[model samples]
Target chain A: MTDDREKRRLDNTIMEGLRSMPEVDPPKGFSARVMENLEPKRPSAWTRFRLWLTEPRSVTFTPVRMIPVFAAAMVLLVLGFYAMDTNDSGNGMRMSTIRFVLNDSGMNARTVAVIGSFNSWQAHDAAMRFDDATGAWVLEAQLPPGDHEYMFLVDGQKLMADPLAQMTRDDGFGNRNSIVFVNGTYEQAL
Target chain B: MALLAFFLLSASCAWAGDAGFVKMADRARECGVSSGMIGQIESFTAEGSLSDAEAVSLLLPLVAACADNFPLASFEDKLAEGFAKQVGPFSIVRALDRKLDEFRFARDMLQDSGGGVAQQALVVLGEGLSKGVPRQDFKTYVSMYGDHAPELFLTGLEMMSLLSQAGFDFRLTRSMLDVGFAGKGLSPEWRYFVRIVLVARQRGLTDDAIAEAAGTVLEDSGSLADVAVHLGFTSRDLSGRGLSN
Candidate 1:
C-alpha cells in the first residue's frame, strides 16, 4: 500500500512537471509567411485575353488558332444551309434534320452507333455511318438547350468514346463518353 | 551628393547593359528557389565582378523569388544548370547538392527531434510508465497528446531508456511514458498491465505473462530488448520466461 501510494505521488509530481513545462513555440511568423507565400496568383480570363492581344508573337496563337476559327465558320455555314433546306416551315423556328456519321476503328468487326439520353439509349436504328469521301464521322442532331451524355456503341457489344467530343464522364465501367451542351440555338460539342 | 551620383551611375550602368544575369534571376525566381539559395547562387555567379557585399545584396531578392516560385527539386536543377554554364557542372552540382542536403537534413532533424505535442506526449508517457503510475492516471496525463500515441509511445520507450541510463529518476521516465500513451483509448487495466510488464521485462523479471504482455504491446526488437536490458534481463528471458542463472 505504501509503495502504491508513493508511486501515485511520484506519478502526480511527474505529470505536473510535464504539464507545467511551457510549450515550445514554432518559429515566429511561420504560418503567416507560408500563407503570404501561397496566396494564389491565377490570371483572369480577361487578363489572358489582354495578354494575348499584347503578345501577338506568342507561339500559342498560330495556324492552330486559325484551324479552330475556320472550323467554327464552316459549321455556321452548314447550319445556314440546313436552315434554308427547311424553309418550308416558314415559321422562324423550324426543326432541321440532323445527320450523323459513325466510323469503326476497332478490329472487332462490329456495327457502331451513337446513343444518348436524347435518343432514348437505342443503338441499332439510331447509329450514324462514316462518310468515306470526307474521312470524317459526323453527327447532326436537333437538340434543345441543356446538357446531354452520350457514347458510341461499336459492334453491338463494345462502347467506344468520341475522341473529338469536348467533355466526358467516367462510366463506372472504366470508360468515358462525350457530353454536349446546347445553349443559344447552337450547342457546343464537348 | 557623391553617394547619390554613384547610385545613379550604377543604376544607369545596370539599365544600359544586359547583365546576362537578369534572365537567370528571372528564371531562378520562376523556379521557386529559396531566397537564401538564390542569393548564394547569384553571389557565386557575380563573385569576381562585384564586391562581396554588393553581390550578396543583389542575390537576396533572386533567391527569395526563386524560393517563392519553384519547388525544391526544380530550383536545385535550375541553380545547378545556371552555375554549370559558368563554372564546371560537376563542381556546382556537388556544392549545391551538399549545401541543400545539409539544410534539408537540418530541417528534417528538427521535425523528427520531437518539437511538437507528439514529443511532449512521449516525454510524459516515459515518466509515467517508469514510476508504475496507474494506467487511468497516465491516460488522463496523456489525454491531449492526440492521434500519434502509438508512434510516440514506441519512440518514447527508446527515449525513456536513454533517460534512465542517464540516471534520471523514475518520476521523469514514468511521466514521459504516460504522455506517450495519452488519448490512445486503451483501457486503464490494460495500460497498467502493459506498463508493469514493460518495466518488469526491462528489470529482467522472469514472469511468462509479463513477457507475453510485452510481446503483445511492443513491436520492435531493439526497443523490447532495450526495455529488457534496462530491467537487467537477458534476451532469453523475453523469448520465454526462464529464471536467470
Candidate 2:
C-alpha cells in the first residue's frame, strides 16, 4: 500500500509539470493542407482510357458459337478479293447484258444480226434467233457500259435501224444506226 | 543473228501458202507492231476472210500506222468489220483511207491544241469531230488535260458525241457537261448521263423538257439517279425490259 501511494504521487507530479508547459502555434493552412491530402484523387481521361484498354479480360467463345462468325469473315474476305479482281481484270470496264430485238414486219429475213460500234460493226457472232411467238429476232449480248450504236443486218446483207429506238445517228455511210446505252445492268432495245 | 533468224523464218512462212498469216505477223513485228496487235491480226487473218493478196494490201497501212506509233486498233477493227460485212477489199481500203484521214485530222488538231495525247483520246475525238461535235467546245478541256490526263478529254468527247447523236443542242449539252465536270465524284454518273437522257426520251418527254430536267439536276450538282427521279422515273423504269411488238 505504501508503494502504490508513492507511484500515484509521482504520476500526479508529472501531470502537474506537463500542465505547466506553454502552448505553441501551428503554421498557416496546415489543417487545410492536411485535409486536401486526405481527399480522393481522380485520374485523367487519357489515363483511364489507357487503363481500360490495358485491363485484361477473358473472351469465351465455343467452337460451335464461333462457326458462323468465322464463316461470315471468310465470306467477306472472298467478296473483297472478288471485287478487286473484277475491277483489276476489266481495267475499270464493267460488263452488262443488253438485249437487241429487231421487228421484221414482212421482210422474212433468213438471218438477222445486230451490228454496231461495240463489235466494230461486225455481225458474225451477233446473229439473233427468231422467236416463233413474237416473230421478232432477239439476241442478248454482254457489252461494256457506254453508248453503243448498232443496226440490224438482215440476210447478211441489208442493214436497218430499230424502229423503236429512242435515238438514231447518221452512220456517215448513208445509213442510220440506233444508239443504245448500257450501265452495268440488263438493257433492251426494241 | 536474231534479225537473220527472223528473215529466214519469214522466208519460210512466205513460201508456205497456208502460213500467210505468219508472214504478215513477221512483217508486222519487223515494223514494230505491238505483239498484242500482231495477235489480233493473226486471229483476223485466220478467219480466211481475205486472200493473201488482199491481206498484203491491208498490211501496208497497218505497218505505216505501226511505224508512226499511231492508234492501230481503229484500223484493225475496221478491217475486221469489212471482212465480217463481206465488203470488197477495195471498199474496205477506201473506208480505211478515210478513217486514216480522220485520225490524222484529229491528231493534228490535238497536237495543235497542246502536245502528244493518248491514242484513245485521239480516236474518240476523231469520232466526235467527224460526227459534227463542235471542235471549239473541246478547247478548254484539251488545253487543261491533254498531256497528263488525256482520258478526261476522251470522256468529255464521248459525252458530247452521245449528246450530239441524241440531237441535243450543243450549247445545252456543253452546259450540262460543264456542270458535271465541276462537281466532285460525279465522273461515274457522267458515263451514264446519256442513258438517263435516253430513258427520258423514251418516256415521251420533249427534247426541251429533257434539257430542263437535266439542267435542274446539274444545277443542284445531283447524280444520274437524281436526274431520273426528277423525271418521275424509278430504277425499274430506267432498267431495261423486253418489249414485244
Candidate 3:
C-alpha cells in the first residue's frame, strides 16, 4: 500500500510539470502576415467580365411550380402573337401566324379549305374553320418562303381561286391558279 | 429650264399638229391617254402611210378598248414598241387587237377552269405568241396541271420556256416541269427548280438524267444546297462546265 501511494505521487508531480510550462504565443504580426498572404490579387475589369461571361450557372425549379410558370409563358406568347397581328395581310411568312382568310357568304357551303402547293392541293387536308362572327372561312398555315399556287375548294369540290389574289397563273388548261408570292415580294395596292 | 422649254415646244407643236389627228385626239383625250402617248400616236399617224384620221380613228379606240381588260400602261408600252420598230399605226393597232384577244382568251380559259391566272401571264402569253410557243401548248399545260395548282402549272410553263431559251429541248423542259411541279414547290421553290434546269443545262446533262436527278432532289432534298448535292452541280461547277449557257 505504501509503494502504490509513492507511485501515484510521482505521476501527479510529472503531470504538474507538464501543465506548468510557459504558454507559447504566436510570433508578432502573425495574423497580419497570414491575411496579407491569403488575400487574392484584384482582377482587371476585363478579366472580371470574362469570368462573368464564361461562368456556368445552374437553374432549378420544382416540377409542380413549373405548371403555372409554363401557363403564364403560354399566355404571354399568345398575347405577343396577338400584339403583332396586323390589319394588313401579305403573302410572306414573316411571322408564325400567317392567316389565310376567305370570305364566302350565303353560298350554302358545308366546308371550305385553302389548299395550295404547301398542302399538295388536297382540299380537306388543310380544311378551313368557319368563323361564326365574320361569316367567313379562315385557315392559318405557315407557308414556306416562295411563290405558292393555291385555290379554295368548296365542300371538297368546286376548286376556285381567290378572286382577290395578288396574282394569278394560267393553268395552261382553261383555269386560273391563284398566286401567292411569299417572302420579300411586296405587292402595292393598285 | 431646257425641260420646260422642250415641253412648251412639244405642247405647241402638238396643239398645231392637232389638225391631222382630230378624231384620234378626241378619242385619246376621252380615254385619259397621256399627252406623251398621244404625241407618239400622232407622230406615228403623221409619218406612217395610213390616213391619220382613219388609222387614229380605228386604232386609238382599239387601244382604248383594252383599257378595261389590261393595264392602259401595258397597252401604251406595246404601242411604243410598235413605234420603236417603225411599224405603221394601223399595224400597231392590229397587233394590239391580237394581243388583247390573246389576253382575253388566256384570262377566259383561266376563269373557266377554276381561277388562278396571273396578270403577268398576259405578258407571257403575248411573248409566247411572239416566240412561236403554240397556244395549244399553253392550253395543254394549263389543262394537265391547272386543276391542282394554277401558279405551279404556269410556273412550269415559264420554266419550260426558260429551259428552252437555255437550249434544252421541249421534251427536257417538259420533263423537268413534270418532276419539279410534282412537289408543288413546298421543298423547293419553282424558281429553285428553274435554277436546277439552268445548272443541268450547264453540266450538259441529258434531259433524262436531269429529270431523274430532279426526281431524287424533289423526293429527298428540301433546300437549294440539297438540290445542288443531289444534282452534283453548283455555281462553281457551272463555271467549269460552260458559261456560254
Candidate 4:
C-alpha cells in the first residue's frame, strides 16, 4: 500500500509538471497526420444498443422477400440523387443531365447534331443518335444550369430551332434558336 | 463505384426493348429513347384522318420549331390536350405556336423583372394576357415588384385574372391591385382579401365600398380572414354583408 501511494504521488507530480508547460499551436497538417494514424473507436454500450433498437430487421426476409425492400431503397436513392442533381446551383456552377430529341426535321437527312452554348456552339459535335424505341433522334448531355441557346444541324447543312420549345429567341440572323434551361437538380453524392 | 454501376446497369435494362417499334434505319443516328412513344404516335396517326407521314410531319415540328428550352413533356401534354379536344392538326400546331410565344413573352418578362417563383408568375402572366390586361398594366406590376421575388407578382396577377373572370374590367383589377398591394410587398393575408373582394363584386358590391373594406382589412388588427368573413363569402351572419344584403 505504501508503494502504491508513492507511485500515485510521483504520477501527480509529473502530471502537474506537464500541465505547467506552455501551450502552443499544433504544426500544420498535425490534424491530418493524427487522423491518418488514429484507430477507429468502438461505440459505447448505450450507442450500440440504440443502433440495435433502430435497425429493425424482419426474420422472415428471404432473398426474394428482400428484393422488394432493396428495390424500394434503390428507387428512393435514385430519386434522391436526381432531386439533388436538378436543384443544386451553388456558386454559379450547375450540372444537369439534359436529353435533347428531334422528331422529324426532314425526310432526307444524313446527320443530325445538337449545337448549343454549352458546347461552344459546335455544329457537328454533340451528335444525336436515332433512338430505336422512341423513333426520335436523341442526344443526352450534362449541361450547366441556365438558359442555353441551341439549334439542330440537319444533314450537315440546315440549322433549325426545337419546334417543341415553349419559348423562342431571335438569333440575330432571321432564324430562331431553341433555348434549353438546365436546372441541375441531380447532384452526385460523391 | 460498384453501387453506382449497379444502379446504372439496372436502369439500362429498364428502358428495355419492345416490339412494334420501327427500329431506326442503320443510317439513322438516334439514341436515349427507350419509351415506346413511336408506336403510340403510329397508333395516333392511324386514328386520325392524316397519313402517317403527314401526322408525323405535323407532330415532329411541334418541338423542333420551338425556340428556347421548352419542356417536351409540357408540349406533349398540350398536344394531348388538343387531341382530347378533337382539334385538327393545323389548329393544334397554331395553338401550340401561340402558347410557345406566350411562354417566351412571360419568360422574358420574368428574366427582366428579376424575381423568384418565376414559373407561377409566368402562369399568371399567361392568364393576364388571355384576359387582355394592357401592356402598360403589366409594366405597372412588373415595376411594383422591383427587386422582389415573384411571389407577390404571381399573387397580383392571379388576383387580376380572378377579377377579369368575374367580368370586372382590367381597369378594376388594376385599381384593386393598386389598393391591395399598396404596401411594401404582399402579405399572404392580401390574397384572402382579394378573394373576399371577388365575392363582394359578384354580389354587386360597388368599387368604393370594396376599396374601403380593403383599407379596413389592412389597417385593422383583426386577421384578413376575419375581415373576409366580415365582408361576405364566409357563412357569417348577415349583419356584416354591407352592400349586397
Cα lDDT tens digits, model 4, A1-190, are 9999999999999999999999999999999999999999999999999999999787755798889999999999998997685554455565666778887634546678877656655555688888767667888776764446577878766776787663345442335656554332221210
The TM-score obtained for chain B by all candidates, in the order given, is: 0.24, 0.70, 0.64, 0.63
lDDT of 1 by residue, B1-245 (tens): 33543454355346425544555455556655455556655666575644433333343333543453312543243343333223333333333333333333333432454543333343334333322334443343233333344555434443343333333344644543453355342322222222334346355555454444444344332244444454555444433110110
- Estimate every model's Cα lDDT from 0 to 1: 0.45, 0.67, 0.58, 0.55
lDDT of 2 by residue, A1-190 (tens): 9999999999999999999989988899999999988958899999999999999999998999999999999999999997865443256565656788877788899999988778767788888999989889999887776667777889988878888777777654456768776665222221
Candidates 3 and 4, the one with greater lDDT = 3
lDDT, residue A184, candidate 3: 23
lDDT string for model 3 (A75-163, tens) is 99997886576323354244233466777668878998876656655555688889899877888776554446567778766777786
Off by over 4 Å in 3: A1-190, B1-20, B25-35, B43-68, B88-94, B116-118, B149-154, B164-171, B186-189, B192-203, B221-231, B236-245
Candidate 3: tens digits of C-alpha lDDT, residues B88-203: 44455555655566667767767666756567665565555533456666777677666655565555666554444344566655565565666654331444354455556556
What value does the lDDT take at residue A120 in candidate 4? 52
The stretch of ten residues in a row with the least summed lDDT in candidate 3 chain B is B236-245
Residue B131 of model 2 has an lDDT of: 60
Which residue ranges in model 2 land beyond 4 Å of their true spot? A1-73, A76-92, A119-124, A184-190, B1-25, B29-54, B132-154, B182-186, B202-206, B240-245
lDDT of 4 at A93: 68
